[model samples]
Target: MRRLGTFLLGVMLLAGPAFAAPLAVLVEERARSDYADSLPPEGAFEITVKEPPKGEVLTLAEFWMDPRSGKFLANAVLETGDVQRIGGLALITLPVPVPTRRLLPDEIIMEDDLTVMRLPVGRVGAYVETEIEEVIGKQVRRVLTPGRPIQAQSIIHPLVISRGDRVEISFSDGLLALRSPGRALSDAHEGQEVRIVNLISNKTVTGIATGAGTVEIVQ
Candidate 1:
């Protein structure tokens, strides 16, 4: 590993005439990369080149320095392809949505439960939540730690109506509207069909659960 870094540095120093003067450089590479699909081999060399070829982007470049010296300086690379000397503590972080408080399993999610904050990008997953609407009203599928990134699979559409619950059955056609007290024969969520028992007529009917404690007759 050391030999490869040294070889890269030697090649980079020879990139242009500006770095021809004998000098030593220290460098570090980001091991993680951002991508939605297939990610290419993780690499993009950023070396201290006094003057890289103007208007031309360098690809497959390398940087290295002699290891004989006991002293080495710390440095960081910026998004604009600039090698900067790190003189003090630089907290590298990435923006991501995280839970404001610890969330227990099966807890209904609310907009106030989450907040966007900066975290180490490497520790965040590709499917981390990015918007408030994504998690709002969702049911927590697993326990979530406070201030930790919320993943897509951590929440789900909650079952609005559970089994054996009383519900208002609504039937409508044209200008006619009728409502009857009914009991849910099976658990269901919004927009899902459930078997309902009309309490007044004592007859079973299938309807779509439309809201809290409510269902619409299919017919």
Candidate 2:
């Protein structure tokens, strides 16, 4: 086993250059609103770099705009110990609008002079830099693509649950009783679902409810 481990380590070292280089492609946008406002609001402007040349990892950095003009300057470091060459760059532009709201008199008075004057009116923008690499080890070769629009539904789960409800709990063979303290629980019903949370690992599992205050985890 030790010999096998050493062999694997040697192989990894030999392939380090090809695998260690970071070539990340990221999507960035600016919103002209306060934290209380909804994020990624409709019609918000966005800028994207669809495809960036792959290179060894060095330093990836970005700078914010002057706020007066929606422009950003980006820079990157390559594994070849040289800065990225300027050219063959692809950029994507999206136009988004900002919404207006009433600000409290106190809020207006507490603003910083620099930020207050540069406050975004209807549009904002950002620049992003990422270190990424091509996916490897898979049977099929896949091109590395970034800035793909992520569907909102992908991260959302459909469940009907409300706060402060009396609920039951059941496990593999034993039934445990617990109360809901007005928190997020997936849609479940009596004698229909079972849920378990592993506090140590912060993992949750769902199963079936067999009876009142009793749940049966379908292993």
Q: Which candidate is the best by TM-score?
A: 1
lDDT of model 2 at position 150? 17
lDDT of 1 at 12: 62
Tens digits of per-residue lDDT, candidate 1, 1-219, equal 334434545566578532222222223222112121322233222234443332222222333233222122333332234443322211234566678899998899887888877654455568877666778888888898988888888887787777899999999996899999999889787899899899999999999999899999866
C-alpha TM-scores of all predictions: 0.52, 0.21
**Model 2 TM-score, all chains together:** 0.21
Candidate whose lDDT is highest = 1
- Model 2 agreement with the true structure over 126-173: per-residue lDDT tens digits: 421110111111111122122221112222121223222333433443
